[model samples]
Target: MFVRTVYATGDPAELGTAIRALNSEGRDLLEERPGYRGAGVFVDRNLGKLLTVSWWESEQARHNSDEVMRERRTALLAPFAGTLAVENYEVAVFHVLPRPTAHGGLHLIRLEFEPADADQLADAFHATVVPRLEALPGLARAALFLDRERGHGLAGTLFTDHHSLAASRAAQAAARQAGAAKVQMAVVGLEEFEVVHADAHAG
Candidate 1:
C-alpha cells in the first residue's frame, strides 16, 4: 500500500473554512477517481495545524491522481494561500496487517501528536498497539506515518465494525494502564470519518 499525507499550518481563525474546503475536495476525489481508497482529516487542538491522510493501492495510482488533486487543491486554497502553508509527502513506510471478522459499521481513528514525542509514540503503537489490535475481531487494517522533517505524525486503524473498534479501544486503554512508555503523549487531536467510497488500483 502507498499513503500520501499532507500537512498544513494556517491561521487558527481560518481553520474551519480551510477544513471544509479540504474535506469537500477529498470527497470529490475519492468519488471520482478509480484508484482512491479512503481518507481521514485531523486538526490539532491548538487549531493551527491540519493533517490529511489518504491511502492508494500503489504509488502509480497516487501519481496518476495528482494532477486532478492539484487542481482541486489550488481551487480550494486560492482565497487563503497567504494564510496557510501546505506540504505533501510520499510515505516510505506503509504496512497493513489482516484482522479477524468484526461486527457493526466500519470506523476510522485519526490520531495526532506533539513534535517531541512523535517517534516514541509511534514506536509504542507499532510494537504494542498494532499487534494487540490485529488480534481483535473486526479489525481490518492499521497504518502508521511520520513526517520526520516536518515534525508531525498520523496513524489510522480500520475496523470491520463498531464492535471491533470498541474492542480495540478497550485494548488500548489496558495497554496504557500497564505504563508502557512516557513519550509525552497528548491527543493533539482526532477526527472521526466514514469510508464513503474506495477503489484499489490493480498491482
Candidate 2:
C-alpha cells in the first residue's frame, strides 16, 4: 500500500474544530474516492501541528486523488492556516496487536539515511525493533513508511493510553537508538501526538 501525508501547523485554539472537520466531512469525501484503504489523523495540540495519513491501494490511486485531496485540505485547514507540506510514502511495515483506538497516543519518529541501505534497514527493523516494541506494555500498532528515493522514513508506535505511553518512553528511546544505529539512520524528528481518528481495514 501507499500513503500520502498532509502536515501543517495551525492555530492551537482551533485544533478541536479542525479535528472534527477531518473526522466528519474530510473522511466522508475521502471514502468516496477510488482505492481508499484507510486513514489516521493525529494532532499535537500544544504545537498546533496536525498530520493526516491516507492509504491507497496503489501509487496511481493516490496520484489520481490528489486534486480532490488538496481541495478538501484547503477547506479544512482554512480556519487554522499555517505552513503546509505533503509527502508520499510506501508502507514498508505495518504491525497491529489489539487494534488502535481514538485518543490513543502516538510516538512518531522521522529519519534520514542512505537510500542504498534500504534493504539492510528493513532487515534490522524487523529483526530488532519489532521484537522490542512487541514486548512493551499497552502497545497497539507499529508502522513504517518510506520514501526510498529521498532517503526519508517515518515510524510510529501507538499506545492504548497516556499511562502506557508514559511508562514505555524510556524503553522506546533505548530501542530506537539501538535500531537507528544498526542501520546508520539519523533520527531527525521525534514527537508525540494524540490519535484523533483511526480507521483501518485488513488486507
C-alpha local distance difference test of each model: 0.55, 0.86
List residue ranges in candidate 1 displaced over 4 A.
Answer: 5-68, 73-122, 175-182, 198-203
Candidate 2: segments with Cα more than 4 A from true spot: none
Q: Choose the strongest candidate by lDDT.
A: 2
- For all predicted structures, in order, the TM-scores are 0.52, 0.96
lDDT tens digits by residue: candidate 2, 108-177 = 9998889998778777887889999988888998888889999999988998887888898999898898
Report backbone clashes per prediction.
Answer: 2, 0
TM-score of 1: 0.52
Pairs that clash in candidate 1: 101-138, 102-138
Alpha-carbon deviation at 70 in model 1, angstroms: 2.0
lDDT of 1 by residue, 91-203 (tens): 43344544432223333333445656666766777676667666767666655666555555555666656555666676755644331454544444444333322223223
